[model samples]
Structure formats: C-alpha cells, structure tokens
Target: MSAGMAGREAPLSRWTLLAFAFPAAPISAMGLPLVVHLPPFYAGSLGLGLTVVGAIFMLARFWDVITDPVLGVVSDRFETRWGRRRHWIVLSVPIMMLSVYMIFMPQGPVTAGYLVFWLFVLYVGWTLLTISHISWGAELTPDYHDRSRVQGARELLLIIGMVCVLALPAVIELANPENLAAARVASMGWFVLILLPISVAVAVWKVPERKAPRPEHVPFGQAVKVLIENRPLRFVLLADLISGVSGGIVASLFLFLAEDVLRLGKFSSALLLCYFISGVMFIPLVLWISRRFGKHRTAAGSALFNAITVPLILLIPAGHPELALGAFLLFGVNMAAGPFLFRSIMADVADHDSVQTKQTRTGLFFAMLTSTNKVGAAVAIGLSYMMLDVVGFVPGGENSAAALDGLRAVYVWPATIISAAVALILWRFPLDEAQQKANREILDRRMLDAAAAAVETRTLHPGDAQSSGAPAD
Candidate 1:
C-alpha cells in the first residue's frame, strides 16, 4: 500500500499527538498578545506613538530574514543524543522567557530603544523555537493526510491558547477597568511565564523526534537553486504570505477596531474570545473537509469565504457589541482553515524535495515558510499603522468621524482583497496526495537500497570472496 494509505491504516494515537502539540498553547498565548494587545498597550499606556511602535516591530521582523534560514540550516545539520530539533527548543526557552518578561513587564520608563532591543532578542528565540518545532512536525510523518492531523492539532491548541489568555484581560477589563493596558500586559506576561517552560518540557520529554535520512550538506548556491525550482513551495509560500498579511492586519487592528471604530472598547477582548472560540470550534470541520476534498481546495474555499464576508464588518453598527460579536463569529468560522492546511501542504512539498534532491531539507523549507509569514506580518503592521497615523487616528482617544472612516477602511479592504488572492493562488496547487504518495514510495525504496548495500558491504569484504575457497576453515 501507499504511504498515505499505510498511515490511514495506523494513524498516530491521540496521546502521542497531544504530547507533541502541547507546546503550541503557550507559544500562541505569547503571540496573541503581541498582535492584539501589545501594540496598543505600548502605544497608549507606555506613551510611545503608533508609528514608532510599528516601525520597531517591522525592523525586528526584518531581522528574522537573517536568523530564520540560518537557524534552519544549522538545525537541519545539528544532531544530538536528544535529537536535532528538541535541543533547539530547549535552548530557546530561556531566551524567550527573558524577553517575554522584559517586553511584557518593563520595569520603568520604556523607550523605543528598549522595545527595539528586546524585540530583536524575542524574534531570535521565536524563530528558533518555531522553525524547530514545525520542522520536527513535518518530519514526524510522511503521509499526506496524517500531516494535516498533526498541524490541525497544533492550530487547535493555538486558538485555545488565544482564547484562554484573552479571558484574563477580558475579566480584568470587566472588574477593574483601570490601568487596563498595564493590567493586560502584566497578566499576559505571567500567563506565558508560567506556561512556556512547562509546555516545552512536556513536549520535548514526552515526544520523540522521528529519524529521517541524514541530509547531504549542499552548498548555499545549489541549495538556493533547489529552493527556487520548487514550484509547490512557491505557491504555498505566496498563499501563506497573503494569508499572514490578512491575519496580521486584522490582528493588529482588532482592538483598535473594537474600541475606537466600533465603540466597543470594553467588549474588545470578549469579541476576540468569541472569534478564537469560533476557530477552535471550526477546526475539526475544516480538517474533515480537507480529508473529503483536497487540502488546497478546502483552504481556497475558506479564503474565498473570508473574502466574501470580511467587507460586512463595515456594516456593524457603532456601539453594538452583540452585532459586532456576530460579525466576528461569521468571519472566524473559516479562520482555522488556511494556516494548518497550508502547513500540511508544505510538508508534502518537503517530501517531494527530499525525493528529487536526496537531501532532507524540511527545516529549510519550513524556515522559508516561517519567514514569509513574518514578512507579511511586518509589512501589514508597519504599513497599516503608518496609514492609521496619516489619517490622524489616535488610539484610546476621541477621534473625528473622518478618522473613524479611515480606520474602518484600513481594517476592511486590504484583508478582503488579499484573502481573495490567497484563494486564487492556492486553488490549483500542484502537489496532491497521489504525488506525495509517489514521492514517499521512492524514498522508501531508496532507504531499502541503501540498507542492503550497507549490509552487503559489511558481510563481504573485498578479500573475502578470493579467500573463500582457500580459507575453508
């Protein structure tokens, strides 16, 4: 039977998947605040303006252009008794924890310099952990459909993390309602601090990284050539970039849209809770749809659904949190569809690359994928914030109607159009189950051949055959 068919015959147990996916919860908790809460907190509570915060975030992300691929290459080559990917995860925990503390709970007088320095450290750690973790997942199973289950489980935990973390700020918003920004950041810091180490330990200790073919060390130029020739990787990266941009813009502006434009400041966190809860609810359905159809088709349909429905956000009446919640719920139903599906597709691409090149470059491919996501996020946050600034849209302050209109425009149109483009780009993605299955079979044969050759060489030295007749002893 084919690799995918074999995988269907013996899928990973739920406990194994859970042990592997647990770390996603804490990582995503940190991420949710960075996109939804940190920008506003820094801009409004800490007295740094939007433009400065956006520029700093953008610059920090650009730093990843260097770190991500470099770490990817290094990790791919790295091996230890523990494993290639797990050590990096352990190494990242301290760096990430320290940076999280500094950024989320600054001691005194925060400045642009403080933000810049800590953000740089944070991204390095983030890239290390994220690329290693994902590369590990991609290497776990070669089966096309099983890859989706792995990624789906991770994304599910991610949304759950977002929901759980948002609950803290939501409750704080309701109870105290004073120094809310400070409280939000502080609570998030504590949540992440307590959870990140525990989650990392559990996953690294309980789950073992699967062994793969040791990759030949290709020169940089040839490696670049291989990456360029990868058509499926290109398509997945483009689709991911567009989706990331859409998500980044909406995430960066969600609180702003909730508080300033929709006049539901107190309900902002609650609305986010509703949105993420919707995603958590819908992930299983999306995964099932991908199983029924193809991953690419399901992802495209989801993107199209978002594109069609996002513009309706403009119609939400001012100060109507209930109406806004309904709109957010509508928009969020397909939110879980694109990310995990594209990641699973990329895993298949890595398999194809391995077959053609005879090199395991899963880490590098996932790094490129991660880099595009960061680039999209950087551009979205940088440009969107600058645009908001140009329109004189102030945060946590009264705004003119023109400013509100500008906010609404910036929030709605870019995401709507870009999400549509994602649909088009991924509609006919070249890689599919049959292709990946073929690649897997090829790899399996190659492995068997190599093993047989090794055994034959060990069993019969060059002199053995010649001496066989004479050395009858």
Candidate 2:
C-alpha cells in the first residue's frame, strides 16, 4: 500500500465536499419535474393519450430496474485512469444530456415509441450516474459523523434541486407559451445540458479517490451470497423498501387527498412548498440528532414520530391549508431524518461488507438501495391508483362521500403501518460506533497486508505476476 493509502484520511475539504455534492442538485431536480410536471407536459402539451403516456413511463421505470444492478456490478469491477466512479459518471452525463434533449425537446411527429425509447435511454443514463455517485459518496468517508455529513450534504442538495425544479413552472408561466409543456420541457433540457456536465466535471477533477484494491474476479454467486449474508445491508434495505413504499403512496395520493379530503387543491403549491421548506429548515436538527443519538435511533425515531403524525391528517378538516402545512412541518422533519440516516446507514453496511469479504461492493450496496427504492415506489403508486379506482374515486367527476373517505384511508393507513414497521424492523440494525470503527480498522490492516504482499510478489516474480495491475472486469 502507498503511504497515502495507509495513512489516515484527511478531513474532506469544504470545496471538495460541496463539489462532490454538486451533481446531486441537477439529478434530484429531475424528480419533482418527472412525476409532477413531465406527465402533463406529455399528455397536454404533446397531445399524447393518458394510457399511452402511463404505459411509456411504466416501461421506462421497469427498464431502469434491470439496468441498475448491472451498472452497479459493472461499476464495482471497473478500473480506469480516471478511477472507477468518475469514469462512469463522465460516461453517463453525455448519454443523459442527449436523451434529456430528445425526450424533452421532441421533434416532429412524436409517437408512443419515441417516448418509450428516449425515456428508457434517459433512465439508463440516470441509473449509471446515480449509482456511481452514491457509491462514490460512500467511499469518501469512514467516520460516522462524516458519513452523515456527506449524505446530509448530498440529500440537502437534492432537496434544493427539487425546490429549484418546483419553482421553474412558475417562472415558465411568465413566458406564457401557447404550449406550456413544450416550454417547460425545453427549459429542463437546457438545465440538464448546462448543469450536469459542469457539476460532474468539477467533482471528477477536484475530488481525491481512495482507490481500494479491486480483486480480479468475484464470482457471481459469491457476490449474491455476500449480499444476502450481509444482515445489516438486508435490514437497511428492507427498512428502506417499507418506508419507500409508504412515502410513494402518500405522494401518489397527495393531490387526491388535497382536493377530496383537505380541500386545499388550490393551495397545493403552497402546501408542497411548505413541506420542502420545512425539510430544508430541519436538516441541521436531523444531523444533530444523528450525531447525538446515532443514525439508527435517529432514523427509526423519526419514522416512528412521523408514523404517529400521519394519521392525524384524518382529523384536520377540509380546506385548512394552515393546519395542513403544520402537519407537514412534522412530516418534513421526520422525512429529513430518514434519507440522512438511511444513506449513512447504507454506507456503514458497505463498510461492514468490505471488511467481511475483503472486497469493495459499495456500488452494489447502493444499487440495492436505489433499485429497491424505485421498485417499491412503483409498486406503491400502482397499487394506490388501483385501490383508488376500486374505491370508486373518479378523476374529474364529483366523488361520493364514501369515495372521499376511501382516499383519506389510502393516503394515511398504508404509510402509517409501513413506517411503523420500518421503525420496528430497525431495532435490530447492528452497526454502532464501536462496530464500525472495528470494521474500518480491520479493512486498513487488510490494505496494508495486500500492499506488502503485492510488493513481495513483484520482487519474487516480476515477469509472472498476473492479478497485479489486472484491468477491472
């Protein structure tokens, strides 16, 4: 091992940290726009049928599911002069930039096939960039609080992106186009074209990677077995799935609840702004909680509190935006905690796994986290839509009293139950400060041993060494 590799890591400089976190803003900026804005842009602006648009989106997301793990595994095994993660990030940016332009700024005679093809292309780029970024962040720090800071900065940037994207439509309204969707989508295309490349380039240039030794070959079955056997990873992923599905259901039903239950349909924008603003405001508090109480307790406690508060929405009368915002303030606090710690916790799981197996699977661990999140969200949204239909809730027509009641039930119950389940399940999460430090200590020793062995083998058989400098698969 080089002296630098064996030496203790310097604390991450603020510029490097912010640059590391920079790309998240644009990437996360896409989230709100994709779900909230893009559908209307396609259906109303482009005159696509709703059924066709829905099918196209579903197909794109499912395709994303397949690509995520593949990309993760590919990234885990990849090596380059630019380093494992930054090279993948660089590769993904151009693909996504072009695809964004294609999807958002469609040319003449758009069809369902056009949407599906370009959207799938967009997801491919998204998977590559996101998985690489997450795993890279996990690799950046080993200290518990530092990991929290890294993910917190990343999550904070993501929310900033979401807030920024949410504000764009209002800006677009001032442009006053005959086709709002066209202008909005075009603006998003330009945003990605400009921001994605610059942020990614800055990170690639400025950040220093701790290049862990990559073994020449890890069998497919062995990778699966390690993943399955990592109890902490399994627990965290399960907690993520349950909470992710709950949150997805709430998001899917939020507009319906705003209209039919809370009667704040007109104030939906204000209400959403409140949720995000409160989230941004509460990040420091969540981080403080994580540092003081540990990530597991902070996340689980936040979810438990959130679970307690979600059902209280049922008690708020119709048309009370003030009360709704107040409720969401609590929601935002708890919401902030989950992502902050969940990602932090996953970093620990990655570290723990690397220690156990003597291999780095940071990318694959985060792949499980990101892919499960997408899948769970998809299932939740589909089931929520199905249940709403079964409960006789009409889209535009006057809904019955019973239908409104069902909407409230759908929004509140699934989330509450699942969040509580997440809290309960996290009670068994194994990593604590001592355990994590012990894992890192062992990993450091392993690095020293590998480095010494490499030197000895080179001296003994300089011409015959094989795995030394072998290309990452």
- Candidates in order, TM-scores: namely 0.94, 0.89
lDDT of each: 0.86, 0.79
Across residues 30-83, which tens digit of lDDT does each residue of candidate 1 receive?
Answer: 988888888888887888989999998888878998899899988888899988
Model 2, span 1-473: residue lDDT tens: 44323335676777777889999988977666666556546755677744456556656667767898889989988788877898999999889888888877887798888888888888999999999998899888777788888888888888887777666656887779987657867876677678888989888988977777775356878867887888898889999888878887787667668766778865765677678878988888988988888889888898889789999888988878889988887788766778768888998888888876767888888888888887777667656766877789865458998998998998999888998998888877888877887787777787787777877877777666655663322
Q: Quote the lDDT for 150 in model 2.
A: 88
Error of 2 at 149 (Å): 0.9
Global local distance difference test of model 1: 0.86
- Using lDDT as the measure, the top candidate is 1
lDDT of candidate 2 vs native? 0.79
Q: Record all residue pairs in model 2 with backbone atoms less than 3 Å apart, i.e. clashing.
A: 1-451
Give the Å shift of residue 151 in candidate 1: 0.3
RMSD of 2: 3.8
